[model samples]
Target: MALSNNNSKRATLGLGAIAVAGLVSTPLLAQDAHQLIRDNCVGCHTESGTTAAPSFSRISEQRKSPEGWLMTINRMTHLRGLELTSEDKRALVKVLADRQGLAPEETEGYRYLLEQNTNIIESGINQGLTETCGRCHSEARFALQRRSEDEWKYLVNFHMGQFPSTEFHSMSRDRPWYQIAFNETAVELGQRFPLHSKEWSNWQAAARNDLMGRWRVTGFVPGKGEFAGWMSAAKTAEGRYDVTLTGRYADGAALAGEGKATLYTGYEWRAGLTIDGVKMRQVMAANEQGTALDGRMFLAAEREIGGDMRAVRDQGKTELVAIQPAYLRAGESTELTLIGQNLAGDIDLGDGVVVEKVLSRNADRITLQARAEGAEGVRMARVGTSKQLSALTVYNTLARVEVLPTDAVTRIGGAGGNMPKVRAAYRAVGYSVGADGKPGTEDDLRLGYMPASWSIKPADEVAAHEKDDRYAGSIDASGIFTPGDAGLNPERKRSANNVGRLKVVASVADGDARVEGEGNMLVSVQDFVRRVLD
Candidate 1:
């Protein structure tokens, strides 16, 4: 559906430029930064304390992410008419980010916003903050910053002065909006995210993880399936790495690429790579121990087509990351690939399963032909000292099928418009009911993604009357839903666009039976204003 104009404006103003530039370890010395700040900011912000604007010391009291600092600078440029060259802006952003950025621990739960993950739903938020601030923008927008109690109060007043209609909005009109925001919400935010914290202090003095070696990569892309590979990195400059990724999909398709990565706030990793001719981005964070990098990787053009990535540092230790085609049918033989590092020695596939022949063996990968003899539950696979719990499963019969996302959304676009269509990807998962003999219980054996026939239909009477399934979109055999074109259609009752609420159905063949799974999808209108935050 179309967003309200107020929210659209808020999103446009709140979300600044996408922070994807290659950053340096120290963009500027303290003296150089002071000179640049004086040249660009002292016009409105004086050296000493003033009521008109915050001074440098006062501004430094808060810590934020690189994107957060960029947004603040963009606000100054757009609203306060501050002028700075593109190069100067980048330098200023880098300086501010390094000097006053949030600790890696501070950004723990909010990394999804930085990764631009669209499938998540916000929950467990404070009701007051939801009504006061979340009505216009995501809660992560504010949660990513740290401020003093007075600064939080000042923010509430600033919002009131800037957007006078905020207090009179739908969810605000019935209550004392200003009192709740200024008195209750601001106080809670300040206590929860204090400006001075021990975590930040420790982080400022701690060493950063070195990204200059080989890493084992394992990830699962929603419609494409699982992939495993290796990433090698060499330090090109301070806080920068030249990287290469060599891997393959579960089907043995070659997946290789080269990219440059920038480290921000010590642990935040951002990289741009071209893999198999398609450009992609990686948003990950290095653990404090430098053992692993965990986050999401997506297509640069379409962030929705992405997957969760886990990269373990190759430190001469044996590790089992994943097993391709983790499940096998009982009484059948299948070729299984074990992906990891330093793999060697004896291979175990639990009881009722036999490793008939070894196809290949290597330090990082092992391929073998295995036969399951009526094994009916999860199995732990072991390679020497490395072991993965529930790495494989053998099932005799299919219990049921389930759609990956029980609820999903897509937007129509590209009808002479600037906005591109947002497609939805899905996967059908199978289950075996396990020892519980119940389909949806905890003991139910979990099978991996399965192939299915995809279709769509009206969800309810209202949708049927609108012929939503006929106009909304089409689902391919691979379970990718491509929305219809944008703009008004004369065939509809009120010349409406192709928007609808439909049901997504997946049918999986199981011997003589057809196991079916269903999900709900809303085909909405194109979003006119897009931003990095959302």
Candidate 2:
């Protein structure tokens, strides 16, 4: 993997060098973790006190996510020349993460980084920290850790010492960087994220949840459709599970898979599975109470092609979670599938909508032939005592159309690059202007996702002059954008890579009229270092 440009140099320093080797290794037993760490790490990270380096006790003073510890170990391997077998490195990371990991609550608001959600727009972070730390790497890197004031200050010194260029970076050169980092930023970080907390203590004391048995699952894949399923977990090893999922999409397409999951910090759930022969990965968190699992699942090779997942333990309680094909054309009949746990009882599709007949019924799902009539508005679907708000919408016509994400990004890769290209998916959402008679007003009704023809064009004059739309990428009929190849192209001016700034347009057929929606997209260079976090 090659660094794209000079701007990424500081980010590389902050995030550490990518581990080119020692990533593929045989798994070791959990009992060997301590021995592996002692043999490989004790020389520098001593057992008792700091001598050549910090002691294990000192290292234990800080808590971090598994990715954080992995980066630290990777840094040691690349910088300090600490050599270890792949198995040993993996064991060290697992053991240290278990022994000195953040509590579940401590990682809130930053899970997107761990999940590799690249499109998130970070906000609400302190300006001081953003200017000092986030300029190089994501704010999530520091936000996910707990440290003492002195440790935070020590980190600032370490950065400056290791990367002297930090003092000359854009934000650093204008201010007393070290002084502010040491006195104000470190103090604020310590106060905000102390090494000691009741949450951590309580989490440590609480019993870990056993993720075995069946769970009701619901998810929505963008550009695809909503799906409902059930997952079964069998204990394969301590803190590990073998999972099987069975379900179907709203269009009645079959969805089934088998995967393996490893639990960390008692709550974080990581899994890799092949669903319908397509490889996928899941980053979810089991609730402390052990009832729900919620997070994101995406393609292992293409992280952009995934969906939001929500699941609950199948405890035989009637719970309505979702209604597939959630929108209906007023006065038109359609098949509806209600998914949840122990689904039973009289069915109701709110007012003006009637269930013509029950197609199928089961403890986890219910299929019905239903029709909407007389009105255009959001409807709550009910099955017995369980009801889901806004589960279904009845719309007469679309007053306007909007792209799901107003802004997006894709990467050009696969020209002898280690990282594969990241594709961007789009969906056109239909809306009714509602009784307020305004398209963009609060009362506007969200009809739902609609099928559309997708196209691309230059976003601005510069893009047009550069012929970006011709070289950047292509949007297919299904609204998936596949970027052009990586590396410089002789056809392009200056031999630049096939990168561009463009517009993604979606056209939806609405009777005699065509409703159009447009979104901005940037076809950028490939990421060289793909870390566990970010």
Q: Which segments of candidate 1 are over 4 A away from where they belong?
A: 1-21, 24-26, 46-58, 221-223, 329-332, 350-353, 371-379, 387-390, 393-402, 429-437, 441-451, 508-514, 531-534
TM-score of 1: 0.87
Task: Write one digit per residue (lDDT tens) for candidate 2, span 378-423.
Answer: 7787778763443688887778888856777778877776666778
| lDDT of residue 259 for candidate 2 | 78
TM-scores, all models, native as reference = 0.87, 0.84
Candidate 2 accuracy as lDDT: 0.76
Best-matching candidate per TM-score? 1
- Predicted model with the maximum lDDT: 1
Q: Which window of ten consecutive residues has the lowest lDDT sum in model 1?
A: 1-10
Report how far off residue 456 is in candidate 1 (Å).
2.1
Candidate 2, superposed: residue stretches over 4 Å from native: 1-36, 49-58, 220-225, 329-332, 372-379, 385-390, 393-404, 416-419, 429-437, 441-450, 494-496, 508-514, 528-534
